[model samples]
Target: MKALLTKLAFPILNALEKSEGSYEYSPSHRTILKVMGFLFMVISAVGLYFSMKIEQWAGLFPVILFAGIGILCWIVAFLGSDKAVSKLWRNRNE
Candidate 1:
């Protein structure tokens, strides 16, 4: 189960890791997460609106998935951004 989850999350984790390297300076992980969460929420809202307008239930899947991921990001930001940032820095310095 853990391995399955890790496999599922690998893409997100890799993206976050790569983002750290792409920046010339380290970013505040909390801020980054918050901004990303906000953007995702906006996308979710738009997607949902369009789906409803079209009356297609299938469109809700992606919107719900993005919303769930966005909420998870926000939770991580609030609970562990410091730890995450430290890990990123440590990895970069190694």
Candidate 2:
């Protein structure tokens, strides 16, 4: 299943998994990333609900934005390698 998911999100994974230098990583980074993803997903859901309730198409922008970000977070948090997670977190000390 993981292999299949990794294949499906190859584009995103490929970009982050490429390592050029040393990076700092911690287990908590992945946990925090997953939490952030879940929060973003919740925000997206709320935006979608409000958009429908208000009949305002403009709200779809945020909905899409949050959803895309959330999905990216989830994909990286789960399917991506440690290097990818480190990349996503970026080289803080650099």
Candidate 3:
């Protein structure tokens, strides 16, 4: 049982390592990112829905906190977006 489990796990580990080495974004990965982005948008919408439902939009803290989370998620998405790493950093001339 132990040997079979190890055999199954080894391929997953190797694939993870190979994925980490890739520079160009794969199509499937892009699709996944799109799905994640949609999910986050929905999450923000839900937060707004709750704020409105509770009728606490007039409060300063609630307005700031929920909207602030949505804004933060957008900022993080922009900063951490997938892109090809530039080769200029490497000493290619050497």
Task: Please give the lDDT score at residue 75 for candidate 1.
Answer: 53
Score every model by TM-score: 0.60, 0.94, 0.39
Which pairs of residues collide in candidate 3?
Answer: none
Per-residue lDDT of 1-94 in model 2, one digit per residue for the tens? 9889989999889989776777888989899899999999999999999999999999999999999999999999988878889999894344
Q: After superposition, how far is residue 83 of candidate 2 from its true place, in Å?
A: 0.8
Q: Rate the local accuracy (lDDT) of all candidates.
A: 0.66, 0.90, 0.44
lDDT of 1: 0.66
lDDT of 1 by residue, 1-94 (tens): 6566546666655555554432222456567777888899899999999999999999999999999878767654644434454453353443
TM-score of candidate 2 relative to the true fold: 0.94
The order by descending lDDT is: 2, 1, 3
Worst ten in a row by lDDT for model 2: 85-94
User: Candidate 3: what lDDT?
Assistant: 0.44
Residue 70, candidate 2: alpha-carbon lDDT: 96
Provide the lowest-lDDT 10-residue window in model 1: 17-26
Best by TM-score: 2
lDDT of 3 by residue, 49-74 (tens): 77688876755455456555544333
